[model samples]
Target: MTRSGRLSRDAITAFALLGLIALFAAMLNNRPQTTLSGGFNVIDGDSLSRSGDRFRLVGIDAPEYRQQCERDGVHWLCGQEARALLVKLLQGGSIECRGNDRDRYDRLLVTCRTNEDDINAEMVRRGMAVSFGSYRSEENAARAARAGMWAGNFERPQDFRREEQAGSPKGQDLFAAAADFVKRLAGWN
Candidate 1:
């Protein structure tokens, strides 16, 4: 407020900015929740495709397709194993996914079920994936049982991606990693 008891120009600008941010938050919260059901093609441990659309299992992070882990001093393709488990879970069953959000890759972030089994939680329980924002109990159980990746040592998928990107030509990797770190900090991951 200025001497005249009216909002100053800077105060008005700040209020306008705050209003815009609130509106944006409301719009995002109001996005339509979607449910998809059908046979899906497993793209990886945490990704699926039906028809032409891609979906990512919500609140889980799985190994990259090329990731490796060591158990008993022997290297194993943990990424492949994760994908295989997902495939097995989908076998001889109906698959359904529901969500109201999309990831940075534009894939729908969904909670999926197969024949009444929650695939997302199952994956974490089996140690095929780690909890990103959900399934803490399942992850704890998997860790306690030394199941899947919990049985061995491996780089996190996100860490692997960051390292791989950092190895790319020029400084693009740093920029990308910085952007990703910022997104993570902002809870946009």
Candidate 2:
């Protein structure tokens, strides 16, 4: 009824309601899929265990729990430290992982995220883990900042595993060898 009038008040209200409904629908569609529910136990720096199931974090590699690194002329337990950091991250938070590939060790390779953020990405961003797959930029940033292992001298986790495999007794895993060594030194069995 006014000069060059466009939308009526009732029409504007209807349009606003429609826009809100669309936004709600889009949010629902974008919600993440539920993966698992339970408290997680740390398997290593880059893996989690829950109810006997193992989930390896996708696109990142962390040090083995027994690996060592030299920083400022001092040897540090980088592997164990990484595991501790991951454990801290999982405290009071549930993780949901999404990925279907079973790794060579039969662990589920997944991209896990907590309510706060992506667990895998956070590890790399913290410089506690090295990115593999599509997250190289994150690793680069950590390296630039000299974060975690980047601040010291240490072999990559895969290279460490390869060396251990070579030195291990035929058909015996490194973990078993470590356990056997421990048992022998402890005079158990």
Candidate 3:
């Protein structure tokens, strides 16, 4: 080919290569976007109240208040337990926060961790809460297995909420009752 023709071909190739690189960079830039924050009192295994800004836990599922234990007639209140654990672990110091911003209930979704351990995974791995499926499938499964949720029968946090929303069992509200009880204990006048 002529010199001008060869030069034109090279130019086209260079533009194409640059375009590809731009696309790859864009993908990298638009990644999942998990943020980090600190200084929240993780009051329980499942919940935490924040002082300043907080990042939400993205993928994991936590137990609901009414989630019953697979064995015995006792109620564990797995959700509440998860929050309580967070509170206990986080209160000691500034915890790590990484995840989405808000949950369905408009609370922060965060994976909190101390210098000692990750409080969020601890809850699921220890059976206080559940592994979440919406964000990552195997993440939940792995957490479930690790947490020993499979030793017997139980429900996921999402499933329990769905049933409640569907009004299938028409069960009484445990959260409201418990909150009221707590208020009474605190002498809410």
- Where does model 1 exceed 4 Å of error? 1-24, 170-189
RMSD of each: 9.7, 12.5, 8.2
Candidate 1 lDDT over 1-189, as tens digits, reads 466545577678899999999999998789898998878899889999988899999999999877898898999999999999999998848888999888888999999998889999999999999999999999999999999999988888889878877786443565677888899899999
TM-score of 1: 0.77
Specify the highest-TM-score model's number: 1
The alpha-carbon root-mean-square deviation between model 3 and the true structure, to one decimal in Å, is: 8.2
| lDDT of every model, 2 decimals | 0.90, 0.83, 0.61
Better of 1 and 3 by lDDT: 1
Q: Residue 160 CA error for candidate 2 (Å)? A: 0.4
lDDT value, residue 105 of candidate 2: 85
Q: Which model, 1 or 2, shows the larger TM-score?
A: 1
Lowest summed lDDT across 10 adjacent residues in model 1 is found at 168-177
Please, what is the TM-score per model? 0.77, 0.73, 0.55
Cα lDDT for residue 37, candidate 3: 54
What tens-digit string does per-residue lDDT give for candidate 2 at 62-181?
999998988998999999999998888777477667776678988888887777678888788777888778578888898899998889888989898888888898746777988888
Return the clash pairs for model 1, or none: none
